[model samples]
Target: MSVMIYPQGRTLSFVYGDERILVCREDRPKVTSRVQIKVYPDGRVVAAAPSDIDDHAVLVAVKKRARWIHQQLRDFRQQYEHLIPRQYISGESHLYLGKQYMLKVIESEDHTPQVKLLRGSLEVSVRQRHSGNVKTLLAEWYKDKARDVFARRLDAMLEHTLWVSERPQFRTRVMQTRWGSCSPKGCLTLNPYLVKASRECIDYVLLHELCHLAEHNHSERFYRLMNQIMPGWQSVKEKLDGMAHRLLLN
Candidate 1:
C-alpha cells in the first residue's frame, strides 16, 4: 500500500531524557513504511515520519530508541572531543600543507596584514594601527594560501580525470562546513581551511569533486572510478576525517 502524504507539515522540538530532538514532518508520498531517525556527527537529533504520523508518534518512536541515540552520541563525542576552540595566538600550533607549525604574531608599523611560512612557523605580521580579531586575520591569510595552492593542485590532478573535459573555474571561500563542491556549470568552491590539511587529503577532496563531472552522486561506479584514478583514496580519506574537527571547527 502506498503511504499518502499530508502536504503540510512542520518541525517540532522536544526534550527526550535531557537531549533535545527535532521531529520534521513533510508531505512526501511513499510506498515504504518505516520510522526513520538520524543522529548527525555534531550530535543533532532529527527524526522523520510519514505526514500522517503526528509529532507524538515520532516522539514515542524516539523514546523507544533512546539507548541507541545515547550510544551514537557517545561515539561522536569520543571522535570529536580532541577539537578545541582556537585562540589564534602565538605559541599555538597550526598546520599548513599537512605540516604542523607554531604561530608567531608580529605587530608591525605596516597597515596590511601578511602571513608566511618561515622555517617551521606561521608568521603573521599584523599592523599595529589596525583593529580586528586575530582569528579573522589568520583566516584571511589561510584563504589566500588555499586559493593559490588549491588551484595548482586542481590543475595537476585534472590531467588524470577522464570526466573533466575542460578546465573548471575554482574559487576559495571560508565555508562553515564542507571541504569543497563542484557545480554543473564547472565552477568549484573550496574551503580555505583545506590549506591546513595534507597534500593527499587536499587531492582527495579535489578529485572527489572532479569525479562528480561524470557521476553526480556517490554510486558504486563512482567509487570504482575513484579507485581507478587514485588507488589509496580511502586511506587518505581516513586521515582527513581524523583531522577535520581541528581544521574546520567553527
Candidate 2:
C-alpha cells in the first residue's frame, strides 16, 4: 500500500482481533478535540485529528471503532454482485460514460487490434481472441477517451472557478484506490477508469482537483469553497462512490 502521511501526522496501525488495520493519520491544525474518522470506499481509514493528539490516542480511537469500520468495509464489498473479477471477453458487460455495453470480441488477422463502441456494444477487433489482448486494448481505448473527455471537462470547469487561471498539466493513470490526485506542482494524475463514470461525476473529480489549486488541503475553507461552487457535490460523490466497486473491477 502507498504511504499517505500528512505534514503534521504519521501513519499508525492497530490490532483489531486478528486483523491489523493501518490508519492514515492527519494532524489538522484546526481540529481542536474531536477526531474525525472517515472510512473510504477503498477501505482506507483516515483520521483527521488535532495536532496535539498523540499516536496512542489515535490508535485507541480507531480501535474503538473497529467494528464499525469492518461493517462499512463488508457493506462496500457485498453491495454489488458485479464486483466479481472482469473476464474481458465477449458477452461480458463493460461500462463507458455510465452506460453498460456488451463486449463483442472479433478475431481478425487482417487488421490491428482496435476497440470501438458501436450500436450499444464495445466491439474489439483483435488478431488473437484472448483475455490479455482484449484487456490491454480496452485500457488503451479508455485512456484515449479519458484524455479528450478530461481535457474538455477541465477547460469547462475552469470557467466555474476563478482560482485557476491556466490549464494545468494532466495525465491518465490507473490507480488502485484513488480516482485522481493533484501534485504539489499542480499537475493532475487521473484514473483512466474514471471515464466509465458519468459526466457529472467526471466534473466533480476535476473540480475537486481544481479546488486544490486554491486550497491545498481539505480544510474547512476548502470545503466551504467546494460547497459554494458545487452545492450538491456530496450527493454526486455518493453516486460515484456507489459505482466504485463495479467501475474499479479488474
Candidate 3:
C-alpha cells in the first residue's frame, strides 16, 4: 500500500496487488463534503472533492466499495496474466487497422528503424546492435504511427460528424493510464498504444476526443451525440476496453 499527497492538497491511498485506490479531498467553504468514486478498467478508484473533507468519512465510503474493487481486480488479473510476458519473436501477432499482422523481423544495415507492410506482413528493421531492444524500438515505431494515423482520423471526424470550423492541434505520446484526453483549448493528446488496436478502435478513440470539443462530459447528451455520429459506438467502446486491458498487460 502507498499513500500520496498531491500538491493540490488531496490525498490518495492505493493498494497495488489488489489494484485498489482511494482519494480524499477537503470540502469547500459552503459545500458539504462527499465522496465520488469512479472505477477504471485498470482497477483503480478515484475519489475527489474540494479541500476540507473528513478523512474518516472518505475511508468509510471507500470501504463500502472495497469488495467490488477487489472483484474487478481479480477478474482483470485472470484475464490478462498470459499477456504480461514480453516476447519479440518473429511471426508474433500485432494489431493494425482492426486486424492482426504477423511480425517479420529483418536484419538490415539501415541507420534508423523502419516498418513496412508487405503483402500481409509487417517487416521491421532495426540496427543489429539494437536487436535486443525490440520492445522499446517497436514502442517508438508505434508512437510515430499513432501520431500520423490519429491526426487523419481526427480530421475526418471533425469534418464529417460535427462540422467544426476550427482545426485543433493534436499530439501523441505513451500514456500509462488514459487512452486520450482533450483540453478546452482544443489541444488533444493520444496514447501511443492505440496503434496496437484495430483501425476502428483507434477511430473510436479519435472520435471520442474530438467529441469532447462539443460535449466535455460523459453526460447523456454527450453519448447521444456520439451514437448519432457513430452508430456502433457502444460495440466499439467494448472492444476498445478489452484491448486496453490486453495492451496494459503486454
Candidate 4:
C-alpha cells in the first residue's frame, strides 16, 4: 500500500519495522527558526518546523533521526517491566509517595468499602470480594490524597515563582500522557496519579505548569524561567519519567 500524506499541522507517522513512530508537527515560522525534533519522555516525537516547510520535509527529518527515536522508545518501554495489568487482588503492590505497599483486601459484612495505608500495606475493606470495588475504593483514596498534596505543593511552588501574583485555580484529573497542564486561562490541571511519586517530583511538575502562567509555550523564555525556579528540574524529570509506567499502572 502507498503511504498516506499527512497535512501540514496534523500528526504523522514514520514506520520503522514493526513500530510506528508518531510524529507531531508544529508550524511556527517566526518562533521556529529551524526544524527541531524533540522526543518526549512519553515516547512522543515532536517536530517543530517553520510554517513554510512542507509535510514531506518534516517526515524526512524524522526519518533521519529514526535510529535515535527507536532507542528512546526502547528505554521508555523497558521501564514497564513487571508492571502488568492489575488484578486488584490481595498481595498486589501499589505505590504511595514513592513507596511501594502491598495491597491487602478484606471483606467485611458490616463495614463500608474503604482504603487505608497501614503497616506498609494498602488495606482495602469491601463488603464484596470484587476487584472492581477494590479498584474504586483505591481510586477514591488516591484522589483525596492527591487533592491535598497538590494543593499544598502548589501553594509552596508559588512562593518561588515571582511572576505569578495571584494563585491560579488548580484541579485534579486522570491524564494518560501528561503529569500536569496549564490552560490559556491559567487554570492548572494535574493528574491524580502524580501523588504516587515523591514530593520533589510533584513540586517539579507543579513548577513546570506554573511557568506556563508566565510563558505559555516551551520557548526559550519558558525554559529560562524553569531553570531560574529549579535548576535541577531536568534530572528530577528524568527520574519521574523512568518510573512513570509503574506509577501509572492500573
Candidate 5:
C-alpha cells in the first residue's frame, strides 16, 4: 500500500518473505542524497530515501540492499537473545517494580510450581527438580500481578482524569511493541510485561491510556490533559522504554 507522506512524496510498505519493511522518503537539505536503512529492536525496517528520489527509485534501492538487510536482521535477532528463548535457571536476574532480583529455584514434592518474592529475590518452587518449564510459573505470577496492579492504579487515577460516564474495563495482555492500548469501547489493555516496571512507570502508562479515553490522540490538548493530570509522565515513559532491552521475559 502507498501513503501520501509529504506534499510531493509517498511511502510504501514492502514485504520480503515474512519481513515487512517501511520505505520512507525523507526531506534532506544541504546534504548529499542517500538511502539509509535501519532496523528497530521490534524487528521493523525503515528505509529512508532522499526526498528528491521518487518512490520507484527507492524500491530499486531497497531491492538491491535486501541481502544486507536480511543479514543485519539475522544478526540483530542473534544479539537480542534476551528477548527470546528464556532459560529458567538459577541466579539470573529479573526485574520487579524497577528493581533487579535474583532467581532462586527450590524443588519440592508439591508438583505445582509457585513463585514468591523474598529477601530481594524471586523464590520459585518447582516439582520436577530435573526439568520442567519454570518460566511458565514466573509468567503466570507476573500476569496475575499485572492485572491487580493495573486495576488498582486505574481505579485511583480515573477519578482525577477527564469525563467518562461508565467505568472502563481493564485487561492484561502480552504485546510486542506498545505497552498498552485503549479501545473505543472503554476497554483498556495493559502489557503483562509491565509487572516488572516500577510503580511510578505503571501509573504513568495507565494514566497515559486513561487520558486517551478522553482525548483519543496525542494532540496538544491531549498533552495538556496529561500535564494537568500527571505532570512528570514523559520521564517515566522514557525510563520504561529503556527497560525493554533488559527486562525480557521470553
Candidate 6:
C-alpha cells in the first residue's frame, strides 16, 4: 500500500507480515514541527507532525530510521514464531499472574475440561474418552483465567486512582499487534495473549489505558501523570517492551 501523508504534514505508513501495523499521527498541535515516534504495545507505529513539516522531510526521517524499524519488525516475528510451537504438557512451565507454574495434565471421567491452580502448579483435567484436542481445551482455560484476573486488577486500579468518571468497559481480543487500547468513549480492550506475560506487564498495560481515561494524548503532561501514579512506570515499560513481541506471538 502507498504511504499516506496528511495535508497537515502527518505521515502514515505500514508493514505487513506475521504482524501488521498502521502508523499515523496520535496528535498534532498547530505549532512547532518536531518528529515523535511511538510504537504501541500491540505493534502499531504513530508518528507525530509539526505544522512546518513536509512530505520530503517525513520521507527523510523514515529512511534514516529504516534500520531501526526493520529490526523491530524482525524481533517481533522471531518472538512470535518461537512461542507458537509451545505445547501444554505435563511439567511444562507457564506464567500465571506474574508467577511461573508447572503444568500437570490429569485424565478424568469428567464431562468437561477444567483447569485448576494449586500450590505452584496448574492442573488441567479433560474427559478421558473425549477426542477433543488438549491444546484447545487449555487455551480456553487460559482465556477464562485471564478475564478474571484482568477484571480484578481493573477494579483495584479504578478504586486506587479514585477516578470519578463512568467505569470503562473491557473486552478481550486476539490481536497480532497491540496489548491494549482505550477508545474516546472510555472503553478498554486488552489482548488475551497478555496472559502469557508477567502480571506486572499486564498491569502496566491496564494502567496505560486507565491513564488514557484522563489524558487521551501522550503529551508530556500525560506522561507526568502516569509517572505520578506509577512511580516505576518507566522500568515497567522497559520490561514490557522486551516481552511484547513474545506475548503477541502467543
Which candidate leads in lDDT?
4
Model 4's number of clashes is 0
Question: TM-scores for all candidates?
Answer: 0.67, 0.76, 0.65, 0.75, 0.67, 0.65
By summed lDDT, the worst window of 10 consecutive residues in model 1 runs over 1-10
Cα lDDT of model 2 by residue, 80-183, tens digit:
44355778889999999999999999998998899889989999999998899999999889999999999999998989999788889999888766788888
- Supply candidate 6's per-residue lDDT for 160: 54
Q: State the displacement of the C-alpha of residue 173, model 6, in Å, after optimal TM-score superposition.
A: 1.8
Per-residue CA lDDT of candidate 4, range 69-129, in tens? 8998788667645346899999998999899999999999998888888989999999999
Q: Give the per-residue lDDT of model 1 (tens digit) for 159-194.
A: 899678898988887665578887777688888788
By lDDT rank, best first, the candidates go 4, 2, 1, 5, 6, 3
What lDDT score is found at residue 177 in candidate 2?
Answer: 67
The TM-score of predicted model 5 comes to 0.67
RMSD per candidate (Å) reads 8.0, 4.3, 7.2, 6.3, 7.6, 6.7
Each model's lDDT comes to 0.72, 0.80, 0.65, 0.81, 0.70, 0.66
Q: Write the per-residue lDDT of candidate 5 for residues 1-250, one digit (tens) a residue.
A: 1111111235666677897766544443313557765554545555565456777776787888887777777887887775545466788788888898898888888656788989889989988754355788888888998888888888888788747666799888787656788887768888888878888888888887877777785555676877888887757755665556555546
Q: What TM-score does structure 2 among the candidates reach?
A: 0.76
Residue 88 displacement (Å), model 2: 1.6
Question: lDDT per residue, candidate 3, 1-250, as tens digits?
Answer: 0011111246667564545465534332223356666454555445554344566667777778777767776787676565545466677777766677787777667556777777777777766735466666677777778888888777777776654668889788666757778887868888777777777777777777767777786555666777778888857866675456556534
TM-score quality measure for candidate 1:
0.67
Determine which window of 10 residues in candidate 6 has minimal summed lDDT.
Answer: 1-10
TM-score quality measure for candidate 4: 0.75
Better of 1 and 2 by TM-score: 2
